[model samples]
Target: MALSVREQIADNSRIDILSAAARCFMDRGYAAASIDEVARSLGATKGRIYHHFPSKADLFAAVFRHGMDLNYEAVRPFIDLPGSALPRWRRMAMSHVLLMIDTKPFQRAVWIGVEMHLRGATTPEQRSVFNELIEYRHNYGMLFRNTLLQGREEGVFRFDDLSITNQLMFMTLNSPIFWYTPRVGETRSDVEGVAKKVVEYALGGLSKRREEGV
Candidate 1:
Protein backbone atom coordinates (compact mmCIF):
# COMPACT_ATOMS: atom_id res chain seq x y z
CA MET A 1 0.00 0.00 0.00
CA ALA A 2 1.09 3.57 -0.57
CA LEU A 3 2.07 5.62 2.44
CA SER A 4 -0.56 7.84 3.94
CA VAL A 5 0.05 11.60 3.68
CA ARG A 6 1.28 11.90 7.27
CA GLU A 7 3.38 8.77 6.89
CA GLN A 8 4.86 10.06 3.66
CA ILE A 9 5.88 13.32 5.31
CA ALA A 10 7.46 11.46 8.20
CA ASP A 11 9.35 9.22 5.80
CA ASN A 12 10.66 12.17 3.85
CA SER A 13 11.78 13.90 7.03
CA ARG A 14 13.61 10.79 8.15
CA ILE A 15 15.32 10.45 4.76
CA ASP A 16 16.45 14.08 4.86
CA ILE A 17 17.87 13.54 8.34
CA LEU A 18 19.68 10.38 7.23
CA SER A 19 21.16 12.05 4.15
CA ALA A 20 22.50 14.98 6.16
CA ALA A 21 23.87 12.71 8.85
CA ALA A 22 25.63 10.55 6.25
CA ARG A 23 27.40 13.54 4.70
CA CYS A 24 28.36 14.82 8.13
CA PHE A 25 29.83 11.49 9.12
CA MET A 26 31.68 11.21 5.82
CA ASP A 27 33.40 14.60 6.03
CA ARG A 28 34.07 14.19 9.74
CA GLY A 29 34.87 10.89 11.39
CA TYR A 30 32.38 9.39 13.82
CA ALA A 31 34.23 10.93 16.76
CA ALA A 32 33.76 14.40 15.32
CA ALA A 33 30.36 13.95 13.67
CA SER A 34 27.55 14.96 16.02
CA ILE A 35 23.77 15.17 15.89
CA ASP A 36 24.10 18.94 16.10
CA GLU A 37 26.35 18.89 13.03
CA VAL A 38 23.85 16.85 11.09
CA ALA A 39 21.15 19.27 12.08
CA ARG A 40 23.28 22.16 11.03
CA SER A 41 23.88 20.53 7.69
CA LEU A 42 20.15 20.12 7.31
CA GLY A 43 19.55 23.73 8.44
CA ALA A 44 17.28 22.31 11.10
CA THR A 45 17.40 21.89 14.85
CA LYS A 46 18.87 18.91 16.65
CA GLY A 47 15.41 18.21 18.01
CA ARG A 48 14.29 17.40 14.47
CA ILE A 49 16.94 14.70 14.27
CA TYR A 50 16.25 13.44 17.81
CA HIS A 51 12.55 13.27 16.98
CA HIS A 52 13.43 10.59 14.45
CA PHE A 53 16.53 9.09 16.07
CA PRO A 54 17.03 8.63 19.79
CA SER A 55 20.75 9.32 19.60
CA LYS A 56 23.69 10.02 17.31
CA ALA A 57 24.69 6.37 17.20
CA ASP A 58 21.20 5.40 16.20
CA LEU A 59 21.31 7.85 13.34
CA PHE A 60 24.65 6.42 12.23
CA ALA A 61 23.24 2.91 12.27
CA ALA A 62 20.32 4.04 10.14
CA VAL A 63 22.76 5.51 7.63
CA PHE A 64 24.73 2.26 7.56
CA ARG A 65 21.56 0.33 6.83
CA HIS A 66 20.64 2.71 4.04
CA GLY A 67 24.11 2.35 2.55
CA MET A 68 23.83 -1.43 2.53
CA ASP A 69 20.45 -1.19 0.86
CA LEU A 70 22.00 0.84 -1.93
CA ASN A 71 24.78 -1.72 -2.30
CA TYR A 72 22.33 -4.61 -2.61
CA GLU A 73 20.28 -2.75 -5.17
CA ALA A 74 23.37 -1.88 -7.21
CA VAL A 75 24.57 -5.42 -7.92
CA ARG A 76 21.44 -7.55 -7.61
CA PRO A 77 20.71 -7.40 -11.33
CA PHE A 78 24.16 -8.61 -12.25
CA ILE A 79 24.08 -11.34 -9.61
CA ASP A 80 20.76 -12.61 -10.90
CA LEU A 81 21.67 -12.83 -14.59
CA PRO A 82 21.89 -16.36 -16.08
CA GLY A 83 25.42 -16.63 -17.40
CA SER A 84 28.96 -17.71 -16.60
CA ALA A 85 30.20 -16.69 -13.18
CA LEU A 86 33.10 -14.73 -14.65
CA PRO A 87 31.00 -12.16 -16.52
CA ARG A 88 28.44 -11.94 -13.74
CA TRP A 89 31.12 -11.28 -11.14
CA ARG A 90 32.73 -8.68 -13.40
CA ARG A 91 29.51 -6.72 -13.82
CA MET A 92 28.70 -6.92 -10.12
CA ALA A 93 32.15 -5.76 -9.07
CA MET A 94 32.09 -2.90 -11.56
CA SER A 95 28.69 -1.74 -10.38
CA HIS A 96 29.91 -1.88 -6.78
CA VAL A 97 32.80 0.45 -7.57
CA LEU A 98 30.59 2.88 -9.44
CA LEU A 99 28.26 3.07 -6.44
CA MET A 100 31.20 3.76 -4.14
CA ILE A 101 32.02 6.79 -6.24
CA ASP A 102 28.45 7.96 -6.83
CA THR A 103 27.41 7.63 -3.20
CA LYS A 104 30.68 8.35 -1.50
CA PRO A 105 29.24 9.85 1.66
CA PHE A 106 26.96 6.94 2.52
CA GLN A 107 29.66 4.41 1.61
CA ARG A 108 32.20 6.20 3.81
CA ALA A 109 29.72 6.10 6.68
CA VAL A 110 29.74 2.31 6.28
CA TRP A 111 33.51 2.24 6.74
CA ILE A 112 33.17 4.44 9.81
CA GLY A 113 30.76 1.95 11.35
CA VAL A 114 33.28 -0.84 10.76
CA GLU A 115 36.02 1.23 12.38
CA MET A 116 33.85 2.05 15.40
CA HIS A 117 33.03 -1.63 15.89
CA LEU A 118 36.67 -2.66 15.57
CA ARG A 119 37.80 -0.07 18.13
CA GLY A 120 35.11 -1.01 20.67
CA ALA A 121 33.98 2.59 20.71
CA THR A 122 30.26 2.09 20.23
CA THR A 123 27.73 2.25 23.06
CA PRO A 124 25.87 -0.90 24.14
CA GLU A 125 22.91 0.02 21.99
CA GLN A 126 25.22 0.86 19.09
CA ARG A 127 26.99 -2.49 19.51
CA SER A 128 23.68 -4.27 19.10
CA VAL A 129 23.01 -2.33 15.95
CA PHE A 130 26.51 -3.11 14.68
CA ASN A 131 25.98 -6.82 15.30
CA GLU A 132 22.86 -6.75 13.12
CA LEU A 133 24.72 -4.81 10.44
CA ILE A 134 27.57 -7.34 10.54
CA GLU A 135 25.13 -10.16 9.90
CA TYR A 136 23.74 -8.27 6.92
CA ARG A 137 27.30 -7.78 5.75
CA HIS A 138 28.08 -11.49 6.08
CA ASN A 139 24.98 -12.38 4.10
CA TYR A 140 25.99 -9.85 1.49
CA GLY A 141 29.49 -11.27 1.31
CA MET A 142 28.10 -14.74 0.77
CA LEU A 143 26.59 -13.61 -2.54
CA PHE A 144 30.06 -13.01 -3.87
CA ARG A 145 31.46 -15.99 -1.98
CA ASN A 146 29.02 -18.32 -3.68
CA THR A 147 29.92 -16.85 -7.07
CA LEU A 148 33.60 -17.45 -6.41
CA LEU A 149 32.82 -21.06 -5.61
CA GLN A 150 30.98 -21.41 -8.93
CA GLY A 151 33.87 -19.87 -10.81
CA ARG A 152 36.36 -22.16 -9.13
CA GLU A 153 34.29 -25.26 -9.83
CA GLU A 154 34.19 -24.33 -13.49
CA GLY A 155 37.98 -23.96 -13.58
CA VAL A 156 37.58 -20.30 -14.48
CA PHE A 157 38.94 -18.89 -11.25
CA ARG A 158 41.65 -19.55 -8.66
CA PHE A 159 41.57 -18.83 -4.97
CA ASP A 160 42.68 -20.70 -1.86
CA ASP A 161 40.38 -19.09 0.71
CA LEU A 162 36.92 -17.85 -0.22
CA SER A 163 36.55 -15.62 2.84
CA ILE A 164 39.95 -14.00 2.42
CA THR A 165 39.44 -13.52 -1.31
CA ASN A 166 36.01 -12.02 -0.70
CA GLN A 167 37.51 -9.57 1.75
CA LEU A 168 40.29 -8.69 -0.66
CA MET A 169 37.81 -8.18 -3.47
CA PHE A 170 35.75 -5.77 -1.36
CA MET A 171 38.89 -4.00 -0.19
CA THR A 172 39.66 -3.20 -3.82
CA LEU A 173 36.08 -2.29 -4.72
CA ASN A 174 35.63 -0.20 -1.56
CA SER A 175 38.97 1.57 -1.74
CA PRO A 176 37.58 4.24 -4.08
CA ILE A 177 35.38 5.55 -1.28
CA PHE A 178 38.60 6.37 0.57
CA TRP A 179 40.87 7.70 -2.18
CA TYR A 180 38.55 8.99 -4.93
CA THR A 181 37.74 12.68 -4.99
CA PRO A 182 35.78 14.20 -7.84
CA ARG A 183 37.96 16.36 -10.01
CA VAL A 184 36.82 19.97 -10.44
CA GLY A 185 35.33 19.31 -13.87
CA GLU A 186 34.40 15.68 -13.45
CA THR A 187 31.64 14.01 -15.47
CA ARG A 188 29.94 10.64 -15.74
CA SER A 189 32.64 9.56 -18.18
CA ASP A 190 35.32 10.29 -15.56
CA VAL A 191 33.49 8.16 -13.00
CA GLU A 192 33.09 5.30 -15.48
CA GLY A 193 36.81 5.45 -16.30
CA VAL A 194 37.75 5.09 -12.63
CA ALA A 195 35.28 2.24 -12.08
CA LYS A 196 36.61 0.36 -15.10
CA LYS A 197 40.15 0.51 -13.74
CA VAL A 198 39.02 -0.57 -10.28
CA VAL A 199 36.99 -3.48 -11.67
CA GLU A 200 39.93 -4.76 -13.71
CA TYR A 201 42.32 -4.40 -10.76
CA ALA A 202 39.97 -6.43 -8.55
CA LEU A 203 39.34 -9.06 -11.26
CA GLY A 204 43.08 -9.41 -11.77
CA GLY A 205 43.53 -10.48 -8.17
CA LEU A 206 41.09 -13.37 -8.64
CA SER A 207 43.60 -15.07 -11.00
CA LYS A 208 41.10 -16.43 -13.53
CA ARG A 209 41.85 -18.78 -16.44
CA ARG A 210 43.75 -17.58 -19.55
CA GLU A 211 40.75 -18.03 -21.85
CA GLU A 212 38.49 -15.89 -19.62
CA GLY A 213 40.43 -12.67 -19.83
CA VAL A 214 39.55 -9.57 -17.81
Candidate 2:
Protein backbone atom coordinates (compact mmCIF):
# COMPACT_ATOMS: atom_id res chain seq x y z
CA MET A 1 0.00 0.00 0.00
CA ALA A 2 2.93 2.32 0.55
CA LEU A 3 6.11 2.93 -1.43
CA SER A 4 9.30 1.86 0.32
CA VAL A 5 11.95 4.49 0.96
CA ARG A 6 14.07 3.32 -1.94
CA GLU A 7 11.06 3.36 -4.26
CA GLN A 8 10.17 6.85 -3.11
CA ILE A 9 13.66 8.11 -3.87
CA ALA A 10 13.59 6.48 -7.25
CA ASP A 11 10.22 8.04 -8.00
CA ASN A 12 11.47 11.49 -7.08
CA SER A 13 14.58 11.02 -9.19
CA ARG A 14 12.46 10.02 -12.16
CA ILE A 15 10.31 13.12 -11.75
CA ASP A 16 13.35 15.35 -11.51
CA ILE A 17 14.80 13.79 -14.60
CA LEU A 18 11.51 14.12 -16.48
CA SER A 19 10.99 17.72 -15.41
CA ALA A 20 14.44 18.71 -16.61
CA ALA A 21 14.00 16.76 -19.81
CA ALA A 22 10.61 18.40 -20.42
CA ARG A 23 12.00 21.91 -20.06
CA CYS A 24 14.91 21.05 -22.33
CA PHE A 25 12.61 19.57 -24.96
CA MET A 26 10.25 22.50 -24.62
CA ASP A 27 13.03 25.09 -24.91
CA ARG A 28 14.39 23.32 -27.94
CA GLY A 29 12.42 20.99 -30.13
CA TYR A 30 12.70 17.28 -29.37
CA ALA A 31 14.92 16.71 -32.39
CA ALA A 32 17.54 19.18 -31.12
CA ALA A 33 17.37 18.39 -27.39
CA SER A 34 19.92 15.82 -26.30
CA ILE A 35 20.39 13.72 -23.17
CA ASP A 36 23.56 15.60 -22.36
CA GLU A 37 21.71 18.88 -22.44
CA VAL A 38 19.08 17.58 -20.09
CA ALA A 39 21.73 16.24 -17.75
CA ARG A 40 23.55 19.57 -17.77
CA SER A 41 20.32 21.40 -17.12
CA LEU A 42 19.77 19.20 -14.10
CA GLY A 43 23.35 19.91 -13.01
CA ALA A 44 23.95 16.21 -12.97
CA THR A 45 26.01 13.84 -15.07
CA LYS A 46 24.61 12.13 -18.15
CA GLY A 47 24.78 8.87 -16.23
CA ARG A 48 22.18 10.20 -13.81
CA ILE A 49 19.78 10.84 -16.65
CA TYR A 50 20.62 7.55 -18.31
CA HIS A 51 19.91 5.67 -15.10
CA HIS A 52 16.34 6.91 -15.30
CA PHE A 53 15.80 7.06 -19.05
CA PRO A 54 17.56 4.80 -21.53
CA SER A 55 17.53 7.36 -24.36
CA LYS A 56 16.54 10.86 -25.33
CA ALA A 57 13.47 9.56 -27.13
CA ASP A 58 12.34 7.72 -24.00
CA LEU A 59 12.67 10.90 -21.96
CA PHE A 60 10.77 12.92 -24.53
CA ALA A 61 7.98 10.39 -24.70
CA ALA A 62 7.69 10.37 -20.90
CA VAL A 63 7.31 14.14 -20.90
CA PHE A 64 4.63 13.92 -23.56
CA ARG A 65 2.82 11.20 -21.61
CA HIS A 66 2.96 13.28 -18.45
CA GLY A 67 1.33 16.17 -20.25
CA MET A 68 -1.46 13.94 -21.50
CA ASP A 69 -1.97 12.51 -18.03
CA LEU A 70 -2.27 16.00 -16.55
CA ASN A 71 -4.81 16.95 -19.18
CA TYR A 72 -6.98 13.93 -18.45
CA GLU A 73 -6.82 14.48 -14.72
CA ALA A 74 -7.79 18.14 -15.11
CA VAL A 75 -10.97 17.70 -17.14
CA ARG A 76 -12.25 14.34 -15.98
CA PRO A 77 -14.17 15.75 -13.03
CA PHE A 78 -15.92 18.41 -15.07
CA ILE A 79 -16.75 15.97 -17.81
CA ASP A 80 -18.29 13.65 -15.25
CA LEU A 81 -20.52 16.35 -13.79
CA PRO A 82 -24.26 16.02 -14.12
CA GLY A 83 -26.74 18.43 -15.67
CA SER A 84 -26.93 20.19 -19.04
CA ALA A 85 -24.37 19.48 -21.72
CA LEU A 86 -23.43 23.12 -22.34
CA PRO A 87 -22.57 23.87 -18.72
CA ARG A 88 -20.46 20.75 -18.40
CA TRP A 89 -18.74 21.55 -21.67
CA ARG A 90 -17.98 25.07 -20.50
CA ARG A 91 -16.45 23.82 -17.25
CA MET A 92 -14.33 21.26 -19.08
CA ALA A 93 -13.14 23.82 -21.60
CA MET A 94 -12.34 26.34 -18.90
CA SER A 95 -10.40 23.75 -16.92
CA HIS A 96 -8.49 22.83 -20.06
CA VAL A 97 -7.47 26.44 -20.69
CA LEU A 98 -6.35 26.90 -17.12
CA LEU A 99 -4.34 23.69 -17.28
CA MET A 100 -2.66 24.87 -20.47
CA ILE A 101 -1.70 28.28 -19.10
CA ASP A 102 -0.47 26.91 -15.80
CA THR A 103 1.53 24.08 -17.34
CA LYS A 104 2.80 25.88 -20.42
CA PRO A 105 5.98 23.92 -20.96
CA PHE A 106 4.31 20.55 -20.57
CA GLN A 107 1.46 21.62 -22.84
CA ARG A 108 3.96 22.76 -25.43
CA ALA A 109 5.65 19.41 -25.20
CA VAL A 110 2.30 17.74 -25.87
CA TRP A 111 1.85 19.70 -29.08
CA ILE A 112 5.42 19.03 -30.11
CA GLY A 113 4.79 15.33 -29.69
CA VAL A 114 1.71 15.62 -31.87
CA GLU A 115 3.69 17.33 -34.61
CA MET A 116 6.57 14.88 -34.30
CA HIS A 117 4.36 12.05 -35.47
CA LEU A 118 3.69 13.94 -38.68
CA ARG A 119 7.39 14.19 -39.62
CA GLY A 120 7.82 10.40 -39.51
CA ALA A 121 9.39 8.14 -36.91
CA THR A 122 12.03 9.78 -34.82
CA THR A 123 11.75 7.27 -31.97
CA PRO A 124 11.36 3.87 -33.49
CA GLU A 125 11.60 2.02 -30.20
CA GLN A 126 8.87 4.14 -28.67
CA ARG A 127 6.58 4.10 -31.67
CA SER A 128 4.04 1.91 -29.86
CA VAL A 129 3.78 4.38 -26.98
CA PHE A 130 3.55 7.20 -29.48
CA ASN A 131 0.65 5.46 -31.20
CA GLU A 132 -0.97 5.01 -27.82
CA LEU A 133 -0.54 8.73 -27.25
CA ILE A 134 -2.32 9.44 -30.53
CA GLU A 135 -5.23 7.27 -29.44
CA TYR A 136 -5.29 9.04 -26.09
CA ARG A 137 -5.50 12.37 -27.88
CA HIS A 138 -8.37 11.16 -30.01
CA ASN A 139 -10.18 9.97 -26.90
CA TYR A 140 -9.58 13.33 -25.26
CA GLY A 141 -10.94 15.18 -28.28
CA MET A 142 -13.95 12.94 -28.24
CA LEU A 143 -14.85 14.24 -24.79
CA PHE A 144 -15.44 17.65 -26.32
CA ARG A 145 -16.76 16.31 -29.59
CA ASN A 146 -19.40 14.18 -27.94
CA THR A 147 -20.43 16.98 -25.62
CA LEU A 148 -20.65 19.46 -28.47
CA LEU A 149 -22.76 17.02 -30.42
CA GLN A 150 -25.08 16.66 -27.44
CA GLY A 151 -25.21 20.44 -27.06
CA ARG A 152 -26.15 20.76 -30.71
CA GLU A 153 -28.92 18.27 -30.24
CA GLU A 154 -30.15 20.26 -27.25
CA GLY A 155 -30.16 23.51 -29.29
CA VAL A 156 -27.44 24.94 -27.09
CA PHE A 157 -24.88 24.95 -29.87
CA ARG A 158 -25.02 25.45 -33.61
CA PHE A 159 -22.43 24.15 -36.02
CA ASP A 160 -22.52 22.48 -39.40
CA ASP A 161 -19.27 20.57 -39.31
CA LEU A 162 -18.59 18.94 -35.97
CA SER A 163 -14.98 18.15 -36.68
CA ILE A 164 -14.20 21.63 -38.02
CA THR A 165 -15.85 23.38 -35.08
CA ASN A 166 -14.00 21.14 -32.63
CA GLN A 167 -10.73 21.93 -34.37
CA LEU A 168 -11.50 25.64 -34.22
CA MET A 169 -12.18 25.43 -30.48
CA PHE A 170 -8.88 23.56 -29.90
CA MET A 171 -6.95 26.09 -31.99
CA THR A 172 -8.38 28.93 -29.95
CA LEU A 173 -7.69 27.15 -26.68
CA ASN A 174 -4.12 26.28 -27.69
CA SER A 175 -3.29 29.75 -29.10
CA PRO A 176 -2.52 31.07 -25.62
CA ILE A 177 0.28 28.53 -25.34
CA PHE A 178 2.01 30.13 -28.30
CA TRP A 179 1.97 33.73 -27.06
CA TYR A 180 1.03 33.77 -23.39
CA THR A 181 3.70 34.94 -20.99
CA PRO A 182 2.73 35.44 -17.38
CA ARG A 183 2.80 39.03 -16.26
CA VAL A 184 4.96 40.05 -13.27
CA GLY A 185 2.05 40.67 -10.89
CA GLU A 186 -0.43 38.25 -12.34
CA THR A 187 -2.27 36.04 -9.86
CA ARG A 188 -4.31 32.88 -10.23
CA SER A 189 -7.38 35.11 -10.40
CA ASP A 190 -5.85 36.98 -13.32
CA VAL A 191 -5.02 33.75 -15.10
CA GLU A 192 -8.54 32.45 -14.53
CA GLY A 193 -9.94 35.73 -15.78
CA VAL A 194 -8.05 35.31 -19.02
CA ALA A 195 -9.12 31.70 -19.24
CA LYS A 196 -12.75 32.66 -18.69
CA LYS A 197 -12.53 35.18 -21.46
CA VAL A 198 -11.03 32.59 -23.76
CA VAL A 199 -13.75 30.08 -22.96
CA GLU A 200 -16.47 32.68 -23.57
CA TYR A 201 -14.94 33.77 -26.85
CA ALA A 202 -14.53 30.19 -28.05
CA LEU A 203 -17.97 29.04 -26.95
CA GLY A 204 -19.58 32.18 -28.35
CA GLY A 205 -18.75 30.97 -31.82
CA LEU A 206 -20.92 27.91 -31.34
CA SER A 207 -23.73 29.33 -29.21
CA LYS A 208 -27.12 29.69 -30.85
CA ARG A 209 -28.83 33.04 -30.62
CA ARG A 210 -32.02 33.32 -28.57
CA GLU A 211 -34.77 35.94 -28.49
CA GLU A 212 -35.06 38.21 -25.49
CA GLY A 213 -37.03 36.63 -22.57
CA VAL A 214 -37.44 33.45 -24.59
Model 1 has a clash total of 0
| TM-scores of the models, in the order given | 0.92, 0.92
Q: On a 0 to 1 TM-score scale, where does candidate 1 land against the true structure?
A: 0.92
Which residue pairs in model 1 clash with each other? none
lDDT tens digits, residues 83-169, model 2?
788899988999899988987888898889888787765557667888988788878888887788888899888889999998899
Candidate 2 worst ten-residue window by lDDT: 205-214
Candidates' lDDT values, in order?
0.88, 0.86
In model 2, what is the error at residue 91, expressed in angstroms?
A: 1.2
- Tens digit of lDDT per residue, candidate 1, span 1-214? 9999999999999999988889999988898899988998888988899999998878888999999999999989878778678899988888889999988899999988888788888888667889999788778777787778888887777889888888998999999998999899998998899999999888888876577665
Q: Report the Cα lDDT for residue 13, model 1.
A: 96
